[model samples]
Target chain A: MIFDDVTAVWNQFNLTERTIEHLWMFSIALTISVILGIILGIILYQHKKYAEPALNGLNALETFPDMALLVLLIPVAGIGEVPTIIACIIYSLLPVTRNTYTGLVSVRPEILEAGTAIGLTEADIVRNIRIPVSLPMIAGGIRIAIVFTMGIVTLGGIIGAGGLGAPLQTGIVLLLPDVIIVTGLWVGILAVIFDGCAGMIEKRLTVRYGEW
Target chain B: MTSIHPFETIDRIELSHLTKTYGDVTAVSDVSLDVIGGELLVLIGGSGSGKTTTLRMVNRLIEPDSGIVRINGTDIREFDEVRLRRNIGYVIQQIGLFSHMNVGDNIGLIPKIEGWGKEQIDARVHELLEMVDLPPEIFSARYPRELSGGQQQRVGLARALVMNPSLFLMDEPFGALDPILRKQLQEEFLTIKYDIGRTIIFVTHDIDEAFKLGDRICIMHEGELVQIGTPEELIFHPETDQVAHLVDANRKYRHIETFTVHDLMSPLSKREFYEANMPVSEAMAKILSDETGIAVVMEGNNLRGTTSRQNIVRNRKKNLLLGDITTEPITVTPEDALVPVLQKMKTKNASSALVINREGEVTGMLIPDSVLFHII
Candidate 1:
């Protein structure tokens, strides 16, 4: 059962190139999400008026269906990893951006007052106390985003982005249950592994900073 | 010692007509007071009474909407904010040692920022750790999480003192500590102050702490100074009902000068005399022992001193020559305050004091009971 005739189908499936493309798409999406999310988070934290609007926009983005977002991006960037990554990044940004803004703002007032009283410059306060203390929540947000994007990246393969999802889409149309189950299992395992690692990092940061 | 510089002599600090408003609420209003150099002046008030706001205005942490803060003869506004803050040491109740850095790095920050060489900064950090009773080798490499609350505070003090700034601004540095730890830190701060000789502006809501550490206390109410004076001046003569209530809790520690042996010491009289060669055994029997215990010992035309029961018990021998068995006792002059005398008693582990005169002779012996009587 471990290496049934389904193994033959999987072996000839070109899983290597598909997996690489999948990883490429996932990485591109993650990188873009992290960069854009952090910028948006910092802006939301620093700008008193921007938080509500930015959060509302993110909530609206979250409500949009993943397939619909991919469809929306296709017209702009065309089919393939580019549109796939863009759609996945938009899907992943909501949690990270919102969590980062909340975390930075919720730092204890006493801690900040102590920093100011000790003659720390405004920049020093941000660099030294505010950022470090808010790091656990920031990391948590990123973790959630990564796991959410990984699930979405597989669906991107439906549009010819080239991943395990391509075989998955083909298996579904061709009624090949073996390919569908194997690819789905592997992707699920990868998501769990990635999220577990991020959870560990968040735990360590919390223990160090006495905050989360 | 190098000759004192002109700047060293400039000790006075004055905040005149200070005011601060946050929207509709005024935090401080028209507050003014002069603090002498080398004095630990504590600002005591309840929460929202403007004590912290007033302290903040001195260092320009909170810009006063109006008024001037003068240090020596110059206004603080004349100095750049960064440069002014660099010249003053600040410690707070939370003990905010940077969690990211190890102890040595935190303590070395000021000297490093001041552009000292690596060797000098390291040496200064070592000196400050020892001064604050933390061994550098043990604590310098440890991060803030590894230390206890009290240890963190000690490191905080070391960090504040690292630059050897001329003035210290402490905002309830012991407020977060447990009672026993708070007492220990207060005692340690006193020793540090005596050694460093820095003018200190301290803020505390605790009346007992204000009395214990302050050379002069400034009582504030609703954004204004209620009264400012020495502890004795505040206790014996409070200027307002608010000050009296503020000090009422600390009246016992406040009047410690009255309980000193100096207060009980009687002036020398011609009634007592003895030859220099008097036998110790005979002298012990001749001196009357009462509830107060022991009598004064006069040699020739001068007063030698009193001998205590504890002294006799320690030097027990049959022959007991006065010169052999009797030791010259420690005494205080009439002008010495009871607090210092009590401090000496605690430090030297002594039971009583001898009052001495201008002629280097004992005027009278002062026992603990006599001091207690006067205090009660």
Candidate 2:
């Protein structure tokens, strides 16, 4: 009887189309976040004097309420997917940047000594040694970013981004418990699926570059 | 086979009035020394003695506050630091091979950075790997952690020598190895040191290491150069009290180097020998009551073996022949130098060795009791 009811809800709301929109937002936001995070990390690693303060500022951004961030972006960027995607990136930056910077700086001292002693230029050492060995740490940050991205994209439906959250919103306004339960449960399942994929990718990266 | 020629030229090195200071601590002071071409110069000192600081200055790793380091009669400052380092071999105690790199890649990095053709790089890598006793086909693809500590250090040595540089700067290269491995590497290095005629400045806090490898040893203390001379010169005519004490560390065993087994062993005639067929219980009682706690087992005076109270005590209840419990002892010639005999003692962990003279005669017993007194 529950499976029949779930199918009825799924068709009436067109959950399949909603799922596509949700994935589109997540992919875009995570891609942008990974690139920006790595660049910012490199800058912070080079300017060690500002690394703590800069990371602290990003940490403060993390403390801002997620929905509040989407609403706040609405004034400048208008509503819908633009503001939603921006919110996801803003929330995801701290973990990725912090991890990238820590990975670059935390390379063992003797490894650095060997690099210099063997005549690797400063930039070459960063490129060949530090970055290659830091793959696992950067992968971990991206994994955390994937979780944040998924959560924010789900909330995107409330602002007319039309994800699974929209049906839950519809059910909430009309007080229909069946629609609410089905959409909420479906979004939770999608999050777990996305997180599982991210975890698999992170594991592969760890195997290649973790121990060094 | 190197297309580069910088190494073939600069073989002599001269340091003039080198001094370095960090805040209030002077790491090295007025240290001037000359290194002959193709000779290994060992710089030795205890911790904080500035020996390492002095070596680093030559490579411009740590620039001196005031000094002139000339290689082949030209100032080192005249050469670019990056190129200078690439051309000079460097090895350290940590054996800092890049973990991400396989053995071949690690050695090939220096040449690759210098823009060598791939075939040339591969050939040179293979040659150097062979030189260090790690064959290319088997070991080249293996990661550093896949090798043991001794094997890793050999790769480190091969990596440094890949450039075939005229100069080498080694800092405590074997200090981290176990004693057996350390001794093996030292002997291998001595053999390699002869085949590759290059100027070398080796840094070590270990006195024995310094004496063994150094063509001439330079001693430093409290940021100052105390003396520089051959091992014989430093040991026999120490210029300062600190130098005397530093080299005199092994003076307790100085006779070990000079004297032979003939000069040091207790003659065998002083002891009573026993037949090999003696019963275990009887031998145990005799060895326990004897003044020396040792019984030399003879097969018709052929010196079959020897047993101690510790050896016989375990077999006292068994009806075994004395020969069954007796352990074989290392044999040495009376003309054999005490230094090699001492090495034999350490290798087998033997309590003593038989000092055999010519004409198949066992003339004396070189017990550790007599020699270890000087050794300890």
The prediction achieving the highest DockQ against the true structure is: 2
- Evaluated on CA atoms against the true complex, candidate 2 attains a DockQ of 0.44
Candidate 2 C-alpha lDDT tens digits along B1-376: 2234444655579999999999999999999999998889999999999999999888888899998999888888887777787778899999889887889989998788778999999899888877775657768888887787777888999998988878899999999987535755776688788889778999998877887788899999989988999887777688887887876645556555687788768776634577789898777556533535467788885978877554565566689998887778898998988777887787776646887778877777876432242243
With candidate 1 superimposed using the best TM-score fit, by how many Å does residue A116's alpha carbon deviate from the native? 1.8
Q: Individual DockQ of the candidates?
A: 0.19, 0.44
Docking class of 1: incorrect
Return the clash pairs for model 1, or none.
B257-B338
- Candidate 1 residues lying further than 4 Å off, grouped into runs, are A4-6, B1-10, B22-25, B109-122, B249-376
Write candidate 1's Cα lDDT for B173-240 as tens digits.
99998764575567668878999999999999987788778888898888888888888788768788
Best by TM-score: 2
Looking at candidate 1, what is the lDDT of residue A110? 69
TM-score for the first chain in candidate 1 comes to 0.95
Task: Give lDDT for model 1.
Answer: 0.75
Sliding window of 10 residues with minimal summed lDDT for model 1 chain B:
B1-10
In the order shown, the chain A TM-scores of the predictions are: 0.95, 0.94
